[model samples]
Target chain A: MTNIEINTYLTFGYLLWIIAYLVAFVAFRDRARSGAIFRAALIVLLCIHTGSIVLRWVESYQMGIGHAPLSNLYESLVFFSWSVALALIVVWRRFGTDLVALLGVPIVFLILASTFLIDPNIRPLIPALQSNWLVAHVFTCFLGYAGFAVSFVAALLLLVARSSAKAAELLPGKKLLDEIVYRSILIGFPLLTLGIITGAAWAEHAWGTYWSWDPKETWSLVTWLVYAGFLHARLSRGWSGGRTALLSVVGFCAVMFTYFGVNYLPGLHSYF
Target chain B: MKKSKTMETGSSESVSILFQIKAFFTSVRTTVFLLFTIALGAILGTVVPQGEPLEHIAMSGNTFLYRLALILDINNIFRSWWFTSLLGLLTLNILGCLFQRVPSIWQDLRGRNPKTSFKLHFRSSLTIAQLKDRLVPVGQEIMRAAPVISGTRDTQHYSWVKGRIYLIGFPLIHIGIIVILLGSVIGAFWGYKGHMMIAEGDSSNKFALIPSGEARTLPFTITVDGFKLVKYPTGEPKEFRSNVRLTQDGKDMLTGSILVNHPLTYEGISLFQADYKVLGVKDVKLSFKTKEGEDLVKVADPRHDIDIPGTDVKLKTLSLDPGTIAQGPGIQVSVPGKSDKPQLVSIYQKDKRPLNIDGVEIRFLGFTPLYATGLQIGYDPGVRIVWLGCTMLVLGFILTLFTNLQKLSIELGGSSKGTDVAISGRSRKLRKEFRQKVEGAFAGITELRRET
Candidate 1:
């Protein structure tokens, strides 16, 4: 299929995810058969989403530009939504439940919607971006972002489930929710560290400086410090429950700012 | 006796002072506070335009805010005294925290038993005779299941600990951070960065500093032999390379080429191809045709005069424009004998542009573009140390995040019916998961007991 057709398929996949999540939420509330149907549909949509991304990459090759579909804002957002979907599937399969998917679905939808708002046209790579490091850097960074997104959703659920009995009944136990948040951070932190290191290596090659204290770099460091604080407090201070949840939420906010807000500030990384 | 008493008091007073100082820096609360403050400063640095001149910031129309920024050194916050002091304080705090915790962590690792408050009671039974044979096999199984540090056997008990060695990764990570900070300090004091632009076939031994623009001469001279710019079919730049030769004491030292993302290093100095610029025409070949059906060709140098073969009209080359929208070169020429004003004449390599100057027709033939390569030169003695620290930091993170300290204790008591086995364990991280594994091991041991 053409790239445009692939994009259409992706849009359809996101819609299907939302619908399936709604079904799963209902199933969670009422203990109905819809949960099984939702699970089947989710698997189907994930396959289609993965195919769409692969097709986009193929289309780039056919056009002879021949880069991964991850060099621009539009492609990164689409990749991000796909990552969130993959994380949701993994969390669901590992936990044997779709409770967290109720929170995950909306985030993927929002990001996919934002993707549509930006340009999706495939462009040739600039000389600065024409390196193998681009693939490693962007892929690892987005995966880290996806992990934090999942953790944010889990943290939000933890806060809500702890306060309201109705929410608690519909969700997993508070302990499990906390565990999910911590697990997600455990997955993201190392990936983020790798991403930063790869970016530094790339910078050394492209700009002759390993670290320039650019706005994007500084902001990434800030995000790292915030999460480091969270992990430190949890591991050493024995912090858990609401305080850890709050830290996760705050950490994700910092992540969002580093990803989106830094674009407006003038820096060397403005090529987003 | 009086003097000894005085000395004791003095020593005690000094000891208390040291205790208070260590207590202040070793507090976890101080660490969290320092992290918060550093993060805040970094945010401010990113939000405000940094490294700009004071006058330029003042011209942005917020006089009071600019003054306040100047007072707070926000214009260069990353290198400002306060920010640097905060970093220094953080390094000290980490060192202090490591000092205080090392003793305790060492003590915990050395202690034989788990630090749990739970107590175990042992009793003998009929299967006490089989316990001796089962003890070795059970201990082996536990060691195989996890990373066991040590195993001990008693008459009725078998115990082993796994991953206790990984506890050192925590302190190693803190030490790595300090190493990184030290590297930064060394870089700040000793490193230098400068920029130099060398035209093709030119040489220079001096460059201007990046911040202050002060020219500094190096002990060696660098010569640019050639500069090449390659473009894609789309007319976008693909690569820029500069061939350079270094000379020390008027003798050839090294010859190499620097490209984008590739650099040349010699004698602890590195040169990077940061940018390039095209100069005016080097030489131009022009053909002039007279109305008498005769051809006159002359090669003209830019900024030089050329005489027409059959007329008093003199063609003087003024300047050349590397065509922006049109891909060919355009030459500006002046007819000194005919018109005093210089006229811009377009030239194309494929399609010739004929200009009639005072009734003498001149066709532009060919042109060459000269370029200069801009190089960013840096000398940093601390870069290797920084890279080493980075490597250590990643390794420490991997060890600390992925591994945990675990200890498992099994107490087997022989009862009148059979042997009753109780298994309990503790983990530094992921305790719940460790407990489940211990329970699984316990079930396996029970199955073995029945089989035997």
Candidate 2:
């Protein structure tokens, strides 16, 4: 499909998801009365998301040398949010919605916005990226990033829950938000780790040395450290809720730098 | 024997000292601080040109600032001691954090319920009194409840439920963190990196090693057999590539065309196609002298005076540098012992003019263009550790998110009218969701009881 066609589908999916989210938020007023409507809207948005992804996949195939729609910045953001959507649905199903979705939706929107900064022309990857590890690395990393985004938002909500007694009435209290945030980071961290590992392996294959301290690589390390701190903070008794959430926010900013700022940075990583 | 014993004792003392040092490094705060500093250094490195000589920045701007930047090695941050130490500190911090935290987490995971507060609470979960209501006698029942729904207090009608696969998730988290640290550390310690500029038709693997103190060397020879720049109609490069080979024992080990990003690798070493430069056809040249009978010598270069072993005839170029005068592309030629105003012999792109040096003669050789291909060379031993660290970190994170110790306990006392249900829950990390799950579980129970 052409860029216009793909974007049209994407825009439609984006609208559908937003509508579903709003429906769910409004439906929460009387949950019993709104279950059917919420489920229906959610199903529509999810189905639309799946369809859009499939179409994108098909579009790549039509270009002859098929790609995973993740070779560039815009594609990465879109894919990231898509993974978040799918994973969030699974989380909602297995764990039941306890206002975690509230934390998840904004992340989806942010990822969508990231697409604007990224070039959406669907260009081929450089010769350096023509390795088996590229798929494994990007897939796992973006998925991990999406998971972290969810956790970050959840962590924010957790602080909100803790700060105000009024927040306790809204599905998740501070404790629940903390757990969800921790859980999100837990899932995201491993994926990030996998992503980094795969990237290193690929780097070794392509650049001879695995760690080059490239801006992208360094920022990735920075991202890892913040999450590591978050995990370690648990042992010290007081790095949870707001502080942990704040750290997570900082990590995502690092993530953005690694992904986008590297190109602008005066380093070998600028090529990527 | 006494000397041996003393040696052992001294060794043990040193070992103890080492252990103390290791212990100090393993602290959480140290790791955090290390990460912070490394992050700061990395930010600096990104903002500045890593490993670039000050000449580069000076080539671009102000003398004072350039000199200062040069002094600070801002252009060469990654390889500098201060920056490297920050990285080392970051690695140490990770090790330290693991050293201090893993054991405790493991103990928490391994610590069995030895009639402790946890066991007491576990027993107080909602299965005991409810069992009496069911047909299964409180003492002996035929069926057991689901895992998520089984617990009892220390009353006479209670039974301890062993639902702890979920409780055993902390190790996975710890293991993941450790693995990630291992990967990064391995990468840091075990890798080597360098760069080379291989010209077309060049065979020597004399890679121009980057100045990295002690850790540098080429394990094998990489030859640039040839390079071609295929251009578009617009004169832009459509594709540029170099024929490359890794050779050993006079045998080619690997051969391929390396283009942008498509590097060639031998064993574990890879040569990246980093960059290329245009040459001004002066790198190699051919020279000839019309001898007594034949075009005796098609000398590759005139710098090396070729002696026919037994003949007194020898030819040498007086000048070998980029010599192209306004009128003629000529080199000042000379003969041994009898140098009379060294012959100014002109050479052309294609040999056209012959040198008439009174009685001597010279011919223009073909031009050799200076072709330089930039190759990035690297070897890293710490990469595997880095990869391992990444794995651990990833697994730890996933476990933290996907799994949790979900526990709910309630003690019900018969009050002749109805039973009182006290509900409470505890989770290791994410308390918020744990509370909600417990509350939801209670609500579900209330709904079930009401329906019944």
Candidate 3:
């Protein structure tokens, strides 16, 4: 299929994902399990989403410009949702089949929403991003970001789970939500570490200087520190569950700044 | 002895009260909470403008708020003193928090084991069968030996908890915070950032000095060999690369392409491609009128004073201001010892007419471009320390996320609960997780996690 057609399909999948999740959220009040058709459709949508990413890769290759589809804001959002999908599947394995669907709507809709906000044109990377590390560096960072997005969504649910008595009553306890959140962070933090390192290493290769305190660089480190604090509080201070949710929420806010604030900041990393 | 004791006792009460107050700020929660506030403030600073002059802020639909934001330095938030102080306070709070927690975290890092049964570890009710099954997996994850007893049924569930590396996550993250703070702090005081533009053939040592504009300058010297702006077929700029020879004290430090988004650094001096501009140069022919004959001196220089030989009048090029498509570049020329009015004037371009003078006529010459370059120059002596701390910080996070202290014991012997069931025990920060894993293994098991 053509690139536009593939994107259309992906958009349709996102719509389905939203529907699945909205219904799942409503059903969560009744402690209802997902129907077979709903489960099958959600799985199909997830598969289609994954296929779209791979299709984007193929499209890039077709243009004779072989690069990862993660060089821009649009591509990153698409990849972010992909990461969330993979992570939610992992959460589903642990939490049960239905609870996983609860997170799908936000992840999918957020990705869908980003397509409208970011410029959709596929531009070639400047010589600076022509390095081999561009793909590795950005992928790891966004994957980690995507994982954090999952944790952020889970944290939001935890906030709901904390207040919505029936939701918590039927679902796994605050402890399980905490576990899922921690696991997401646990998975995401290291990837973020790798992302930052890879980005720095790429910077060293491209720009001779490893760290420039470029706004994006600074904010990424700041976000990492915030999440680092979260992991620290949860682990060392013997805090878990509720507190972990709050930390992830804060960290994701930092991630938002890292994504959007750099352009507005006066510092060096404003190049978007 | 009684008088001396009374004299000493008089100040003890005040000393104890002072110590109590001093201890409050030094408390772990207080220090951490304070650091949290600083972090929050730093986030706010990024949102708010930091270092900007009042009159300079562009009035984008609102003249009042933009003017106020400029006064607050909200645009340059990172460099502002208030923001810097917030960073400094954050650094101190993190250090204080780390100092308070490091000893215990260090002990945990040294691989201490918890010598306790799962029942005791729970601090809640636990069955003997539940304790044994948790031992094997938890032992493998933490790489610590399971605390299962070798005794038949007479074991007393002895346990001594140890998990200091688990504590290192906090200190490691604290060190990361300190590194980031150090980078920003040192960068705040020592870092110098500004931009200078160099045309196709430009070289200057004083590029370090901020040019006569409302912009900052660099410290080291930079010579631009040639600026190459590679563009796509559609004319969109693909990349702007500059081959620059960076020097400090006449010694060539480094030379490479400083492209867009790629900064070249040498001896801690970073040259970034902030932007580029074109400077247009024009040529004009000068004629000095004499009684015997005319002396025609061709000049391209825009200097205000050019010596007119054999004549008292000095031919000067006052200014070259490009007017319009029909007019092109204008050159106003005047001779010293002459009137304030231009003795000779020329609007130079092949497309436009030239200016005539008294007893001589000046012809308009062609034009050439001089490109202006902008570079952000920053030199932080503490970047290495900050970078080292950043590396360790990333490493510590990786360890914490991937590794943990886990303890599980599976007793294969006769039941300790007076039943003939195999007893299993488990312990982990992921209480629910360990419960689920253990529960899945045991038939009809209803496991629950109780945090201590």
TM-score of 1: 0.86
Candidate achieving the largest TM-score = 1
lDDT of 3 by residue, A1-272 (tens): 75445666677766766676576666654444444455566667678777877877788787756577877667777777677766766666666645545655566666666687656666666666676666788788887887787788778778888988987765556766777778788888888887887887677555545665566777887887687677667765777767778888888888877887677776765334
Between candidates 2 and 3, which one is better according to TM-score?
Answer: 3
Q: What is the lDDT of residue B140 in candidate 2?
A: 23
Please give the range of 10 consecutive residues that has the lowest summed lDDT in model 2 chain B: B135-144
- Candidate 1 residue lDDT tens string, B4-76: 9999999999999998888879977778878878999999999888888888878989888698677788888
Candidate 3 ranges beyond 4 A from true positions? A17-44, A64-66, A113-118, A127-137, A161-172, A189-272, B1-28, B54-82, B106-170, B209-223, B246-255, B261-263, B280-376, B407-452
Q: Quick one: best DockQ, which candidate?
A: 1
lDDT of 2 at A145: 82
Q: Please, what are the lDDT tens digits per residue for candidate 2 over residues B279-375?
A: 5443334444434534544534544674432255666655543445433354455554445544444454334556543344555554454567878
Q: Stretches of candidate 1 above 4 Å error?
A: A27-37, A56-64, B1-18, B54-67, B104-126, B132-139, B145-157, B283-316, B322-329, B334-366, B411-422, B444-452
Residue runs of model 2 more than 4 Å from their true location after superposition: A1-6, A16-29, A94-110, A113-119, A159-171, A260-264, A268-272, B1-41, B48-117, B121-191, B197-202, B211-220, B223-245, B252-268, B276-374, B388-452
lDDT of 3: 0.63
lDDT of 1 at A246: 93
Report per-prediction Cα RMSD to one decimal: 4.6, 11.5, 9.8
Q: Candidates ranked by lDDT, best first?
A: 1, 3, 2
TM-score pick, better of 1 and 3: 1
